[model samples]
Target: MASRKKNPSKARRYSVKEKEEILRYVDSVNSKQGRGGQTAAVKKYGISALTISTWLRGGGASSFKIGKTSSNGAGGVIAKLAAVHAEIQAKEKELASLRSQFEKLKSSI
Candidate 1:
């Protein structure tokens, strides 16, 4: 067979749900075959062995981390920012109290 160049453009991005479905299929195959047969499923599905392993291990169906890094949640980041802000406010209040005590000692002299 003639060697053909691999095309990166041919790769398709799968959603978390789709990955879960693929993982389910892998698990079904593994259960029927006995032992971890994800290698076979990986070859059959044209997916990487690591991906199959992740699916079999129940690490699939998780979009939370990916979604956090993606453009899906400006709101969540804003909430985090608010929490940081509240913390800074508390620290500023403590600093002000310390400064007030320093001023009181200086004025007594």
Candidate 2:
């Protein structure tokens, strides 16, 4: 028996500006096409539709703190707080959907 070693690949990180550019392009296409624009963005940008969706939903670049400031500064803290709140909301929505699915499955069984 031969043992194979697994190669781990790191996720590519996009700078705030790059993320904004990708999002702007996605928005433009979505506005013109009216639907399935994310699919188009995924194809054009070589990024997953889920990543595009995260950007659209106030995550990604939108969560980044703008300008240089101390961590304890009001602006920095507020921005961080807002980002956390948005993430919490997104997670809550996902949890609700999973719970609904679980309920459906339980009822069927």
Candidate 3:
């Protein structure tokens, strides 16, 4: 076989949910101290620090808002945002159904 550019070991794929979970842990650690969250995450999660850093820069934690160190009401904001997003998705689906129904009624008329 020809030589391959990539390594034989496959790269691990982490879902958005997984990334968020890891990031949350990292956030908690960083908050307790000052920094080194990525390094700490590397030891705990076994994920590459570079990979986590990339995720952080690439908006992997976009699902949850970051920045606030203290627990406080940050969770509340994320919850509200999620609720609103779900509502918008539901509303969009309903609108599409209504549009379909309207078209059917108009054709019948």
Candidate 4:
């Protein structure tokens, strides 16, 4: 059976920070689901499960400049929250612009 990582040349390199983030996400998922955290991370991060397994086994730990992460799985959640907040801000600004345009058109009519 051919694995998903069939082409070595096409394999993407993950940075130390990325690896740690993925590991944290996996930890978060596993803590909540009791298992299948790697799979959840694969779907969320678009990474292969084999890569996550290797990292979990310390295959990529030697070069890792490990940093502190939240124990409550807030690392992943907080990043996502920040992204959503930014999007909401942008949408609000757009809505205000559209409302201003509508008022201008009404006054001109």
User: Residue 72 lDDT in model 2?
Assistant: 32
Expressed as tens digits, the lDDT of each residue in 13-84 for candidate 1 is: 766566767766666766797756567666767878876665445443342234434323576456556767
Candidate with better TM-score, 3 vs 4: 3
Off by over 4 Å in 1: 1-12, 56-109
Q: TM-score for all predictions?
A: 0.38, 0.51, 0.51, 0.47
Candidate with more favorable, higher lDDT: 1 or 4: 4
Can you write out model 3's per-residue Cα lDDT over 1-109, one digit (the tens) per residue?
Answer: 9976977789898765687889888888889988988889999999898998876665445544444331225574566667789999999999999999999999998
Candidate 1 collision pairs? none
| True lDDT of residue 19, candidate 1 | 72
> What lDDT does each candidate get?
0.64, 0.73, 0.75, 0.74
Candidate 4 lands at a TM-score of 0.47
For candidate 1, give the lDDT of residue 44.
Answer: 69
- The lDDT leader among the candidates is 3
The deviation in Å at residue 22 for candidate 4 is: 0.4
- For residues 1-109, write the lDDT of model 2, one tens digit per residue: 9999887876878766677788777767778988777788789889988878876765434444454532334676687777779999999999999999999999999
Worst 10 residues of 1 by lDDT: 63-72
Error of 1 at 85 (Å): 28
